[model samples]
Target: GDDVRVAAFGPNYANEKFTPRCTAVSMGSSNNVQRELCRAKVLLVPTKAEGGPLVAAYAWALGVPVMMHNTGIAASCQECYARLTGDAAADAATALSIVRGADTDPRWQRP
Candidate 1:
């Protein structure tokens, strides 16, 4: 959580300049960006409204765990996703625990 940070990849977000402290976002090639996601330890999707993004599936295919709250995804997505609530620190802690684990396999197993 503290060590690794989140970045967005989409549209003109690649050119948009955000505050230095803000996470890096690339709105460029989806394929390239997705390929890069493979090395990442966590993928956070904290959107307010989403119609189950395909990226979730892609993450699963690559074996990269996910940390989500608010965003929705297709039924087949097996990425480790959590419903964030209560406190922000709690969510961060949850993500930290997952990231710290050595196993690359996702924790979220939907029934």
Candidate 2:
């Protein structure tokens, strides 16, 4: 949406297509990573396959909500999960809904 700001971290060749809409950042130093994570309202891990992303742990520790693919620790944890339907629009809508819920849901509130 127009109200949402997306910042993507890591190497993505198609980052140019999402320019202005998505700000791409490099996964450099730990300090840099922490800074970026701290600025985020929700950490979205949309990967189809992942061994185990420790960034989710860091986000949780920092009191940030996570909306990840239904894999790895996300399957076991009580965090939000993004469904992959092979339809880009549908998947995006689902992701948006999850993000909106995270923003308003009291369960995601920090102490």
* Cα RMSD, each candidate: 4.9, 3.2
lDDT of 1 at 21: 58
lDDT (0-100) at residue 87 of candidate 1? 73
| Candidate 2 lDDT by residue in tens digits, 1-111 | 337767776666455688856655556555577778788777777776886788987777776777677777777875443445667778667666766676677645544
> Candidate 2's C-alpha lDDT?
0.68
Lowest summed lDDT window (length 10), candidate 2: 78-87
What TM-scores do the predictions have? 0.64, 0.68
Q: How close is candidate 2 to the true structure, as a TM-score?
A: 0.68
- How much is 85 displaced in model 1, in angstroms? 2.4
Which candidate leads the pack in TM-score?
A: 2
Q: What is the lDDT of candidate 1?
A: 0.62
Per-candidate Cα lDDT values, in order, are 0.62, 0.68
